[model samples]
Target: MKWFFKILALSLILQSFQFSDTNESPDLITSAQLETKKLEIQNYINSFSCSESGGCNYIAFGSKPCGGPKTFLVFSNSVNLVHLQEMVKNYNEMDNLHNIQTNAISDCSVPLPPTEIKCVNGICTIIN
Candidate 1:
């Protein structure tokens, strides 16, 4: 009877170890989802047209694991600049959070911002 009780206790302990907290938060965004968001933002930026260099502009985009933007995105003033800025800001914040959660590592190299943005064939292009 003592042996039976010992075995039961061992089984119970092992069963407890099998259980885990699988309740992941719904707000958690995965890398794949972030990529999708990026593509969407790029498509939106591409929708705008520019006829003059003065209408072209650039915004720092994406967060590096070590801090700073991963790159810059060129856009035209024909876009809703305020809305685009908000979207990019949110994206950067989300990306930063993802890096923290995943313990991401990077080369820690800082990306240089564009020297100028120019309208080329109705599209905003980055000039470095």
Candidate 2:
């Protein structure tokens, strides 16, 4: 009958909509995942130890929307420098992608690099 055909057509249209492609991508990183990555990097950095001021160093971290790093993180030679740098590099890249995807805004103020890095009580600390 006409009514049965109309119902069938409506069901097919609804099924098509249910299976339609969306804007979301499987590879897209969510804000929560990004935050978790940041925290993991911070915790890794915090675990570093040093016995001498000479062993302390700093690296730029995070991407600002305008340009440059959002901040600098101080670490010590006691940690695996290459591994830490690689982790930070990956984090920076992820953050940059996140900023682009979110259309992030920023004040455009560049964070100043640390004047000095020193070992304080076995931890690397930024000195002004």
Candidate 3:
């Protein structure tokens, strides 16, 4: 029985890796695009839905806009799809790579995008 359990565990581990999928990488941000993305996020902060959580983890150029020495906003509301995409774009520019985990998010009714994304810890999952 012990040997059976060990083999089962080993197989499970191997199978986990076998089905793992990676997301698509976006075009690297240009100096112009980076500046523009920053304004987009800044303008987005005052908007509804996206700014409800105050601000999501986002980067501008190389600056850590959220979760930095100075946080941009408080966790207020659930950030929507558009905002999520923008956040991922900035993350890539700043090299803020996310370690993908299983899809356990309750509100993530939408299918996961084939792109890298960051999550809100135990809450919303980044499906970029």
Best candidate (score: lDDT): 1
TM-score of 2: 0.76
How far out, in Å, is residue 34 in model 3? 1.0
Error of 2 at 99 (Å): 0.6
* Comparison by TM-score, 1 against 2, better one: 1
Write out the backbone clash pairs for model 2.
none
Q: Using TM-score as the measure, what is the rank order of every candidate, best first?
A: 1, 2, 3
Q: TM-scores of all models? A: 0.77, 0.76, 0.28
Candidate 3 Cα errors over 4 Å, as ranges: 1-29, 49-75, 89-128
Top of the candidates by TM-score: 1
- After superposing candidate 2 on the true structure, give the runs of residues whose Cα lies further than 4 Å from its correct spot: 1-26
In terms of lDDT, model 2 sits at 0.85
Model 2, range 22-100, lDDT digits (tens) per residue? 8767466678887898888888878867888448888999999897999998887777889889999998888888888
TM-score preference between candidates 1 and 3, better one: 1
